[model samples]
Target: MSNSGMAIRPVLWDGDVFRVLDQRLLPHKEHYIDCDTSDKAIRAIKNMAVRGAPAVGLTGAAAVALGAREIDARDVDTFMKKFDRLCDRVKRARPTGYNLEWAVEQMRLVVVENLSIGIDAIVEKLREKSEALINEDIEVNRAIGAWGKDVIPAEGAVLTYCNAGGLATGGYGTALGVIRAAWEEGKKFHVFACETRPYLQGSRLTMFELLKEGIPATLITDNAAGFLMQKKKINVVVVGADRITANGDVANKIGTYSLAVLAKTHNIPFYVAAPRSTIDPMKSRGDQIPIEERPGREITHLGGKAIAPAGTEALYLAFDVTPSRYVSGIITEVGIITRPYTRNIRLALQKEAGK
Candidate 1:
């Protein structure tokens, strides 16, 4: 989890400035954007400079702290009003990723609890809390890795979608974290990185990370997944989630649902690795989870070259929901949640609260 080694982190807090690695230009360019204001942080999230559910959540917390440092309010009442507005703005940055709202609420609690002390003290507390969120993200991902690693076969193949590596989160990762943990545990396995279209996070970012770590991985077209599964080349399917409803339905990259369905047909165990913050206990079902529609250009073109005729309308849903029935289990930092997910998810969350 520490970058002191060879790992590169997507998010970092350098003194008062928060830095995020720009993922849009990966596998060719490595760029870091320093966000000194809440507006800058919000823009980074919106523009995809910082992505993945956990990474954005951590960024949201940092954004709140950065906003707090600039607050000019002298009274606690005015400070609360302004802070609440700031939290609302961050929360509205993205709808699919529950982690953003969860992180914002976490940061809000810090401000509310310390408001009686004064704005300066409250800002200081926010700073500490934000930093803790970042550090805790790394720890949480590592814990997820520890728990999910056991699910990996001793020697087989694992199929993963998108770029759920350190580049996707605050430090280690989620699905890729489990992969890394399993590899570190001396489990020999091959990784299939699906070339997730539109964004191509897997082909670009995931491949970059695997190659950097010298992990054995193959780049496959998104549609080739079913063939591989049919051939029994895939042992398990693991992906990270943007949000998980109370019933355990998963919301992830647009192609994730297809992968889950194929895995189900192939009788392969499909797993979702994420931090507890990714779960939305309030949402009873997947249909209630908001789906973000991205620009049509993303689906109509590739690398600035049009794949379709100009003005050809395209649907660009950023994510899709996979029913809990297709999921074999939900991997979290705490542990894996099996069926009867509604009950197990609540029990797991309760245990996390007690901790």
Candidate 2:
């Protein structure tokens, strides 16, 4: 949670206010959207002002807590009704990331347990629970880094797609965390960041983090990834997941599947790094995971400029699923999950729970 002295944090809670780093305008403009109400927080998440699975989850919890404080309910019953509705609204803000639902459920449990105490007590508990979630996210990410760093080569190029650094989570990142940990351990290597199209998160956010931390990194276009691997420049591929199905399938950025396939063909290690909260045990397979579709404007334009003709229409799929077969391993907070991911993921979660 200390951030290893990093300057940027995606989400911050100071007193009653939630200040979120507006990721939509990153790497250039730095601004925080002040959210005092759940609606404001929800909008931030919906608009990509505050994104990433872990960050969204933390935002949802904070929203519930803020909603609990803002709702004008005279009695416990009325308060519970309003708060529960707010929880559902926040959960629905984004459908693909299980962390959003997972965080709401965690906050809901806090409300349920303290409902009998009084409305004020419930509100206070919600605040405490929301803070707990934020702190837990950073801790889990650090643990994930410690567990995953071993996979990084001693001196080789490590490729990452999208933005999964401090800007994507409460503090440390999932895939980037491993890279940072490895770098901290004196593993001198170059990092290749893919300029993820449409969103350009890798170019905008990931590159920003790497530069900030003084990590050696190079930016490449989305299409240039295969060429880099073919030239034997990239050694391993690591990416963060939005949701991991029960069968070990991963749903991440739209182009993640293609990268995974390329890594498999090149016989390179393809790893997914994320906390256990991202693993949705309810979804049996990747096909079962809901892929959120975005507006055509995202694809038809770039940086607020229209690049296509007026009549052009584009289908924007926010995420794509990668079958477990292509994944060399899944790095979690507890440990690395290898083959038979179903069994390993279950056992890892069970162990984490038992702890």
Best by TM-score: 2
How many clashes does each candidate structure show, in the order listed?
A: 0, 0
Candidate 1 lDDT by residue in tens digits, 139-167: 88888888999989999999999988888
Cα error of candidate 1 at position 5, Å: 7.4
Model 2: lDDT equals: 0.91
Question: Please, what are the lDDT tens digits per residue for candidate 2 over residues 241-280?
Answer: 9999988999999999999999999999999999999999
Top lDDT model: 2
lDDT of each: 0.90, 0.91
Off by over 4 Å in 2: 1-5, 353-355
Model 1 whole-model lDDT (C-alpha atoms)? 0.90
